[model samples]
Target: MKRNIAVVWGGYSSEIVVSAKSMAGICSFLDEEKYNIYKIRITKEKWTVEVGGYVYTVDKNDFSYICPISDQRIYFDFAYIIIHGTPGEDGRLQGYFDMLGIPYSTCGMMASALTMNKFICNNFLKNFGIRVADSLYLNKDTKYNLRGIEEKLKFPLFVKPNTGGSSFATTKVKAVDQLQQAIDAAFGETPDVIIESFISGREVTCGCYKTKDKEVVFPITEVVTPNEFFDYEAKYEGQVEEITPARISGEMTDEIQRLTRKVYDLVGAKGLIRVDFIISDNQPFLLEVNTVPGMTQTSFIPQQIAAAGLDIKEVLTEIIENEFNAI
Candidate 1:
């Protein structure tokens, strides 16, 4: 029997386009013969699925839908969440699926919620001996001390939405005068924001996923961007160069893979995730953990999977089947 798989996309954030692209990429990677795939598009308005050339509404009661033509109800066996922001990446969708006894392809509720907040997640990992850049957190109602921030941290800080992704409103502040404007820009996207001391060095990322049978950690990728930083444009606009099997020492690759596994276990992450880092003074500083990483063909995970000489189709199958085996 073929299992029904929901490639859930769209969210209550600006990353909807990225999520849509990821949905297409995932659908292409999954083995069509083994699973009955459906493109489940979600938004603030409604939850829907496209059947044939017509769109049908999905029942939120049990995550099933009735085929008007056949008068048959179709239920999803699993959910492959690809939303990059709120309701999906922040754990809301995971909690919903958990209550319904439906497995998903991402971190659990706690892990998703914990990792969505950059400030809290980094601080939590810091306690586990994870090296992270010094950072400060701020909310829309809180009063931040700019002078204190400057004194405690170095110049050229990164101002970003504490709970946002796709570098939507992230900014690099090189001077005190640019601080206020950067903060405003980040606040425009999210109510809470973070300011972190910039780490200067080569930037690299590693993707990993652990199933019940195997621990797969992909090759590292170096991020080279001409912009001030790896901003929104660089990530989705093809303005950056992502070099796979990063031109680093073999020892460095081992260290990164070790840290990647450690972080995955520490965060209780499920499915595939990408951990970003900046090597300064030969030490890898944790940047941020992406629970619902981009799965587009050009995304880092696909690139790394190819670099590792593994078949993407088999990789997706392993992850999907792992969920059923765990249950």
Candidate 2:
């Protein structure tokens, strides 16, 4: 029997369109023989599932939708969530799926909620001896204290929302003059903001996957954005240059892989995850881990998978198959 897999995408997040695009890429490459695919769009009120040339818009409140085939209701064997930010990445949708007793890819509620907040997540991991950049958290309630923050971290700081992806409101401030403007831009994205000491080094990302037996780490990829920094446009606008198997020494590669596995285990992540890092002075500093990394063709995960000489379809299929065994 072909297992029903719901590729859930589109949410009330800023990355809705990007999520939809990722779903399209995933659906296109998924093997048709092993599983039945459903491109499900998650809106405020309904869960629209599309499969086998038919569409069913189901009321999420009641879990009722028009059956494509017979009158019987359809339940998915697994939900492959592709939503990048907001509710999807923030654990709301994961909790909903948990209530429905459905298996989904990525971290659970606690980890998702924790990691979604960049400042909190980094600090939490720092307790594990992970070296994260020095950061200060800002919110609407707090007064703007630039001098205090500057005392702790020097100029050329990175300011971004506490919870967002694709660098939606990320800014790199070179001096004190740009501090307020950077804070305002980050605040525009979310009520919470994070200002961190900038590390001048290569930007690298490593992808990790958990199988039934062992954890696998893909090659690290260095990101070179045309922009001064890897901002929102550089991420989604096809202007950044990414090099797989980053031109680092074998020792650096091994160290990064070890750190990636450590972080994955620390966060209790399952299925697929991507960990971002900054390499400075021959040391890899932990940046953040992405539980639900983008699955588009241009995404870093796909590039790493290809660089590892594995087929993307096979990797994704393995992830779905391992969902039941993942803790």
Task: Assess each prediction's global lDDT (C-alpha) against the native.
Answer: 0.94, 0.85
TM-score of 1: 0.98
Q: Write the per-residue lDDT of candidate 1 for residues 13-113, one digit (tens) a residue.
A: 88898899999999999999999999999999999998887999999999999999899999999999999989899999999999999999999999999
Q: Candidate 2: give the clashing pairs.
A: none
Q: What is the lDDT of residue 247 in candidate 1?
A: 89
Residues 1-327 of candidate 2 have per-residue lDDT tens digits of 898788889877677878987898888778889988888888776678776677778657534456845877876878888888878888998998888888887788888898889999999989988889999999999886788778888987899989988788788888888899889988888889999998889899999998887667999999898698888788888788899989889999999999999988888887789999999999889888899898887889889999999998988888888876653
Runs in model 1 deviating more than 4 A are none
RMSD of 2: 1.9
Task: Return the lDDT, model 1, position 170.
Answer: 92
Q: RMSD, each candidate, Å? A: 1.0, 1.9
